[model samples]
Target: MTNYGDLVGGDRVHASLYADESVFADELDRIFTRGWVFVGHDSEVAEAGQWVTRRIGREPVIMTRDRDGSVHVLANRCSHRGTALCWEHRGRATSFQCNYHAWTFGLDGSLRAVPYPAGFEKDRVSLGLDRPAQVDSYRGFVFANLDGSAGPLAAHLGRGGVDMIDRLCDLSPTGTIHLAPNWIGHQVHSNWKMWPESDNDGYHLNWVHASMVSSAPDTYYQETVLGGETGNQSLAVDWGDGHVELDFRPSYRRELAWLGVTRERVASYCDALVAARGAEAANRSLWDGPPHGLIFPNLFLGELNLAIIEPTSASTMVHWHTAVQLDGVDEAFNRRILRQSEAAMGPAAFIVPDDAATAERMQLAVDGVQPGWASAADPRGWIDMSRGLGRERTEPDGRKAALISDETTNRGFWRQYRTVMSR
Candidate 1:
């Protein structure tokens, strides 16, 4: 262990945290594999024999529902030949057969049969598919872990963090959500860690997303991001366990309104939510927004979608963006939400590309500058996460809050990061 304390201190994180290959590998071993990471939404495999394949840490895994309605997380590789059992991202299937040797496994990942079973009389190999040590779901968000030693998923979700998922689900009239059929995925040459911190940093929104404001309708911009409007409506929240939320009032609808969604259209949308959860709760979930907060180690729930961050290397990551869909919403409402995802949250989305650029450029800076004697004070290896160090106030529920312009959430992420990595 390379003295993580040297790199991550009380008020600063070494930029090497993002640029070093060893540190990246350490993250995979100590944190990702050892902790629960989001796999797929429960609704994704809502049907019997349905499965969605995704990466958990560096290992490929599958979330499948069997005929008995039991959900199982399998390793996705064959027990016979070590080949991938399911290649398609998702599909409905009763069994997954190895493309190489015809070995097959049932929906629950139990070995159904084998080729020439008589020839294997003395064989002792476990023929069934490998499963993650533990798998669990909270509020329809499924997660899996490679290490059974890890604590339960809810324990990792931190205090009251599960409520965030529930609140997001409640945004739907049926009190549930499902990922749209097609997801928006983009690979970027940047460290995956960049996004966790980046997403938590609401302070950058006004500056980095100035273009977002300039491009929006003047009235909406004036009412929201312009001047003191942001401070009044926005809050910086540290939801602990590396879950940080940028909860703001009057955000989501403002974006739609800026893009020309009429008050009638917005009201109609809110009415469904109001009907589902009383006025106060609906207003909070739908209007007073917990805008696209990042739940650490690669699950991000935002204004419109669920994003999965998968790291390929020290400087490479791929993001999958799934549009949020209410199970029983009006078709037009679903279509409108999908359209918004296409327009603003997709790979080619206006805001996302900007975030990618910042991440890449920041990595370039770390790669571009060396800590020479002349630049020691401003070493390329260190990042100051000390902003708002002493300014944070804790809520009764243990959630930490700070000024919208402060880096309180960023530090909270580091604190958890250091704990996980050092452990």
Candidate 2:
């Protein structure tokens, strides 16, 4: 068994944790199964009979809206023969019929009918479908706990997580955000944890994404994260409970800086937000913009996009993402966001591929490292996360913050991983 306490330290982590199959299996059980994992959004199944297939750790599951407009997460396999019920990524189905056995299941996961029912001896109620103990959502973002032993969703998200989601949804004129139906998954030769770290890492932009900065020197990131210490006022915040953010609000030089355009470019979106939320809130949102943060385990609030970290193995994972479309914005404004998302994170995009390459390289470098090498004397297999550690300060609300080019976000994530795995 891996000693999580020894493997994860305040300022470093054992490299083996990233390349160990045993460690990955333990995480699937400890974190993904017993902890809260983001599944899908409510907007995907706005009406009855709509459903989407997803995975909670390694277990395939379905997210559905039943006849009465209730959301449910159930094992995607048929109760009769263990065959998958939904093959497509998403669809509208009043009932799911098994292809092999013809056993029908309701949207609520109830075993409704089976071919040749007279010979079926099992009680339908007892064999409906396996389900997670808990299913909950906040502002349309859904999450599930496979074993159902975790605490309330509110407790898990904490105030920091709540603020991240609130900041994104509040950008919409309706105070709601809609996720595009299409989700593009990017395959990476690295552990799932790399995403929650790299996605929110404030320290790597100047290095890993140098090409983007060199070509698009006028982009918003030039002001948000490119500047060195004292060059920008952006903060790397550790919002406890494993939630972290690269807050660019202070660094933004002008209103609508996050959009990489002036107010004139999105006049209709600005007008709609002003009319719905009033000038003060709308103006503040425009200046502050959406959050660049990670909500622990799986969710990535990637400003204009939302990504879910899907782990396939110790060295393989899928970064599934969808562009965020505001509910009441003009079609053109949403289109602009879509275009930006494609350029930044699409399959062949500039931003994430570089980070993916870096992560893959790191994986290969640490492929067979042993935890025993993470010793004070040798230090052969440890990744340091001590930047700005001594100077990071605690805010009034209890979160920690440092300069944008700091490792506070990485440390925050590893600390939470240690806590969860230790349990």
Candidate 3:
């Protein structure tokens, strides 16, 4: 048995937790498998037969909607020889068939037919596709869990997390958002935890992303994070249940100085929002637009995009960034959104690569040595996470918040990781 107490300390965790093979294997089973991990956006498979495949935890799974419009998160591996039936990222298909043995399955994963029905002495209808234990969606975001007994999505989201997602969906006048086509993927040579920890972190922006501050467009996000926003509108907030949001509303700008984009654009988007969603809701959005939130486990929303952390190994992981589209917003507004996201989050963009490299570089520092290079007397190495430990304040609305530069969100993550991984 692992002594989780030793791995997770008082606002600090052992360095070995990022490199130990045993810990990595255990995380797949304990945290990812049972938890409600984000699979894909419901909009990705809105139409019948549309599907997308991704890694749910360590296992490959396919998210598809049937002809009847019901969605399923089926294990990607075929039942017969354990072959992956769906290899494409996404496609429109009437059914999935195993190319190796010609085993066919439906969109709902019911095994439809076999090449040789008589080869089985038993009934041919016996074999069928399997769905994850629970699959559900909030707004347009879809999540699945292998644990059948897990709580509903609303329960998992709690108040703060749900509020953050609601803000994201409410950006669209129609109360929906869609996944944009172009997605950027990066295979970072670092521990999976690093990418997620950076999501809700505001401390590293002026330091790690100094280049971004100097070169990138001065947009709503940068202005807020850079301390140009008035009052407490911009904040680092901890949403309960291990979720945290970099809470801030975007400044009104049809065109930003960043990205070298000076053309007047998205001018009437807010007016359209007010017209459709009403002045009260529009004003609320302008005041508290959906902040970039990191859902517990490995899902991220915002920075005008969606990011997923896939744990490939203890020392390596894959991160996916997909630009998101507001359903009722115009092309000009969406174009502006994607342009800003690409300037930093695009595969070749400046910000993402820096973040990815930092994760790997930090992993390289995991030598597991004593502070003074002392003998094996106290060789258990630790990474101090004590920053902002005692400064958290509970908001009247039930969220735990802290200074923008504080580490409250990161600590919230480690504590949750400890609880889930311990069990």
Which candidate has the highest lDDT of all?
2
Worst 10 residues of 3 by lDDT: 250-259
State in Å the error of residue 39, model 1. 0.6
All candidates: CA RMSD in angstroms? Answer: 3.2, 1.2, 3.4
Q: Estimate each model's TM-score.
A: 0.90, 0.98, 0.91
**Candidate 1 lDDT over residue span 72-136, tens digit each:** 99998888769998788888888988889788888878787788888876443466778888898
Clashes of 3: 1
Model 2 reaches what TM-score against the true structure?
0.98
Residues 210-244 of candidate 2 have per-residue lDDT tens digits of 99999878789988887677799999999989999
Q: Write the per-residue lDDT of candidate 3 for residues 40-130, one digit (tens) a residue.
A: 8888888999888898778899998888778888999888889999887888889899999998899888888887677677554556666
Clashes of each: 2, 0, 1
What ranges in model 2 sit over 4 Å off?
A: 375-379
Rank all candidate structures by their TM-score, best first, as comma-separated numbers: 2, 3, 1
Off by over 4 Å in 1: 122-125, 218-233, 250-263, 266-269, 284-286, 368-380
Model 3: CA > 4 A from native:
123-126, 227-233, 249-267, 367-379
